[model samples]
Target: MKAEISQAEKAENLSMTNWFSLLGLAVAVLLSSLNISIVNVALPRLASSFSVPMSEVQWLVVVYLLAMTCFMPIAGIWGDRFGRKRLFLFGIGLFFCGLIACIVSESLTQLIAARLVQGIGAAIFISLAMTFVSDFIPATKTGTAMGILGTTSAIGTALGPVLGGYLISHFDWHALFYVSVPFCIFALLLLARQLPDNAPVPFKLVKSGRFLAQFSENPALAGSLTANVCVSAIIMSTMVVSPFYFTDGLQLSPAQIGAILSVGPIVSALTGAPAGKLTDHLGSGTVVRVSLWIMLLGCLLISASAFWTSVPVYLFALILVTAGYAMFQAANNTAVMTEVKEGQKGVTSALLHFSRNLGLMAGASVMGWLYLFTSTFFPATQNQPATAFGVTFLISAILVGLAQVMVSLRKGR
Candidate 1:
């Protein structure tokens, strides 16, 4: 583990020629990013395909997230135990295999199972993609290189909706799965050609285990983790609900919903880099508090749109949520790691990743439950789906407020 971070420090001293491998790494990151968001556009279509209710079909999202959350720490351990090339290739194979399964699935249960496989693959890749890429670049250039890759994530987030929208609009949902094939093949070929034979970090899990002691004792770390979970939960819950809300409540087409929803990621992409820098200057705690306020406001705006069904209000709300999440993540992640001792960095990072994925699973699962329950209670919510979704968002906003208070009360950083 020390060897792995030491590499990041030494990256600045490497020859420029070593950067050639970054192309392959960037492709991997782009693929991961696109896969993450593209699936959102398919939720409504999946419900139709499986002949399931909006909430029931959400198992596709929830299952995948839970699988990813479960696999993250294991992936990190295995990557160290095995070689990066071998581990990453295995992950790719698993992902494509899962995609194949998804394309061929006959029922919602089968699709959810396939998605679980895909999520495992995603866990492996996402766990190592940035670190793997940094292995080939100079330490001095690592930050900029990582930031460039981060931008690709934003681009992918923006593209997922629009691309998924187009594919589902013109062809079948299968087209969306097909889209990943070229990138996967390209990444596979590139990694095979470019990566080194020897492992960069000494394979170890015991180091990651040490953080459990500190994490349990550290109030600040615990608070940061909780805040991140809540924030991520809110963000993902909105994603799960938006497609249904727009389609059922607003009577919009998949294409229209995709186009409208793309606006948030676009704003997030634009603000994300600057936000990281701002976190450095203002301090993570301060920025995080401000971000929670912005997101709370955003959630309220979207909640209001249930009554009005105003596109303008929705977009405005989306901008706040997207931008707030972008800023919040940068600061929150920085805060978590900065608070940890050097020896505990690996565990802290793993815990942070786990918390983030857990948040995704919780957000989707919880909001899905909330929406279904609200619909059952207020039967009118069946016809006006937005009302049910609006209630969910309001509940999420309350959680965020609670998160802010938690952050405020934390005794350390």
Candidate 2:
């Protein structure tokens, strides 16, 4: 009788924790995605405000990811040592500080530094958000949780451009940064209240040290890492190039561009659960490969659009990319969580996020460099079109091809 009563009590407590954690995490994830989307939309305006070329201004995006990537692994490990809740709060606080710094900055240098701080904080909370989901939910339900998270990501992504456009048009570019601050504070307070308050658990360093070592033995980890980096590179490259292309090549307004761009993420956010279920049925390796193929087609379409100067084709291409992203996220996260060992959930989550942020940094930096190089080396081409951008997409397609191969080899143990 006592055993039955204790089990019921434990179950009830876990259920409460799950609801609280999921609610807080969903809000946090949404806010982050929304801010990112708005930032992407406001990039050109930011460049105009600072009187800098897109090349220099793009560093605002690149530096943020670089800082986040650098911080992810360490944040992961530290969250394990200090308590995930504490780490989560710190990430929020740091990000809020960066936001304040950005608003007041008079120079580009100051803004970049502030963005770096923001990225580091973002890395901490984003990494721990996954850990919280994995810790709270059962393995069988992880796909659902990730799907919900992915959906949250999609919602923010979809809404960002439209909302951001409205803000930039009516208010100003600064409004984009301003909107996220209060929401982030509220989410922080709520998250702190909802998350588990247990003391940090200690684990042996030697056992924890094996994350990379063990990574080699797991095909899922290896393939997922490769896929994440490549796929994200393709996505980020499109983000950097497309806005410029839309305004310059296509001559679209921010409002019009946001409307067009919103389609992909809307498609993605809607398809998340279905994709999760498909992954549950078909397996991660299969789903990942298939999604990459779809993304490949999208990449090819966008590259072709640049060469041919086809506006319709470029818009169509975004749909494919969004669909692939939605499917890939739902399946990939589930595969990763399944592969992680008994301990080190936080670390594993960090590593996955590390791979992702690295991709974001690489995508923005490499593509931005290519853009600047084209402008510098082929001054005549600048008058022509997104001439260098076409070449970048072709390179990204090959990287996607390589990622497809990695996941293909992921078979039975």
Candidate 3:
């Protein structure tokens, strides 16, 4: 047990790395990001193929988030108890299974179910990967390494729409799921070579549970967690309705919407590293405060654009919104990690992940409900859909703005 505890604290004496570990970490991060946006472009195709309403098609997206959210809290604890490497490998295996299942899925139900499984895999890996990085990398090098990871994840999210669009147009949507298999296998193999089993952490299940229950004991944890949920909810709420607004309202094609949606992630990926450095220099608090304002401003910009009937204005607003979100996410993650005890890091990370998932679920559900309400009352033809979506964004902006205020409240003795 003593040996196990020491192993769990492996990074206590860890030195900075070269590039191999960095590359491996990037792969893991990208996989997580891919899960988030990979299905966006496929949504239209999936909806058409499954003969489902656009609103119902969102279940495929939200179900995955629900699974990820529910499982995120425990993933970190499992990492500590079972060894982070073990958890990571298991996650990769699960991801591969999910990919295979997706490729073989025949119905909307099956596809959504498979995505939930994929979300579980992502929840496991993402939480553990963050913990592993903090454990094995030197503190001085952490920001840079994390920057790489963040940027990679953003890039994956950005690329997914364009890549998924191409794949769906040329091949079939199944190809999207199948294509990930090789990468998952490659990632698993490389991870095995690069990561050691090490020793397990002392597993006092009761103690761990008790610790988890005390999540509210840390004010920063609570605040950061709330902030995470709000930000993710706002972002996902926009995502849920954005495609429809672009394609139906603006009379664009799936390819065109894909191209537009693609811009945000690309900007995020390109800007994330510098944003990280900026966070390191300016402090997480400063970054978080600024990002929140920027995001809120973007929301207002979009709201105004909705009223003005300007597509270009909307696109410009979306770019700012995405950039601001990326900045906040990077900074908020760093702050959350710093807020908890070393032993509680995994649980905290998991909590943050959980919050994001829950936020996505909440945001998407609210948007869907609002869309229905608006469509029935205002009719589908004009910009009623946009108005419905715009209202959801306004609400999300308020929630996120409130969260930012909470983050601003400093904890004291």
RMSD list, candidates in order: 5.3, 2.9, 5.2
> Which residue pairs collide, candidate 2?
none
Best by lDDT: 2
lDDT of 2 by residue, 207-283 (tens): 56345764765656777778898888777776666777677766778888778778777888898778877887788
- Local accuracy by lDDT, each model: 0.74, 0.78, 0.74
RMSD of 2: 2.9
- By lDDT, is 2 or 3 better? 2
Residues 206-269, candidate 1, lDDT per residue (tens digit)?
3444445656667677787788788888877766678877777777898898898788878877
lDDT of 3 by residue, 251-365 (tens): 7766776677788778878878877788888888888888888889888878777777787887788878878878887888877665455556667667767887788787667
Q: Which residue runs does candidate 3 get wrong by more than 4 Å?
A: 1-18, 196-198, 204-211, 410-413
Q: 140, model 2: CA deviation in Å?
A: 1.0
Q: Give the TM-score of candidate 2.
A: 0.90
Superposed by TM-score, candidate 1 places the C-alpha of residue 42 at a distance from the truth, in angstroms, of 2.2
Candidate 1 ranges with C-alpha deviation above 4 Å: 1-26, 80-86, 130-150, 191-211, 338-346, 379-383, 409-413
How many pairs collide in each candidate, listed in order?
5, 0, 1
Q: What is the lDDT of residue 50 in candidate 2?
A: 83
Q: How accurate is candidate 3 locally (lDDT)?
A: 0.74
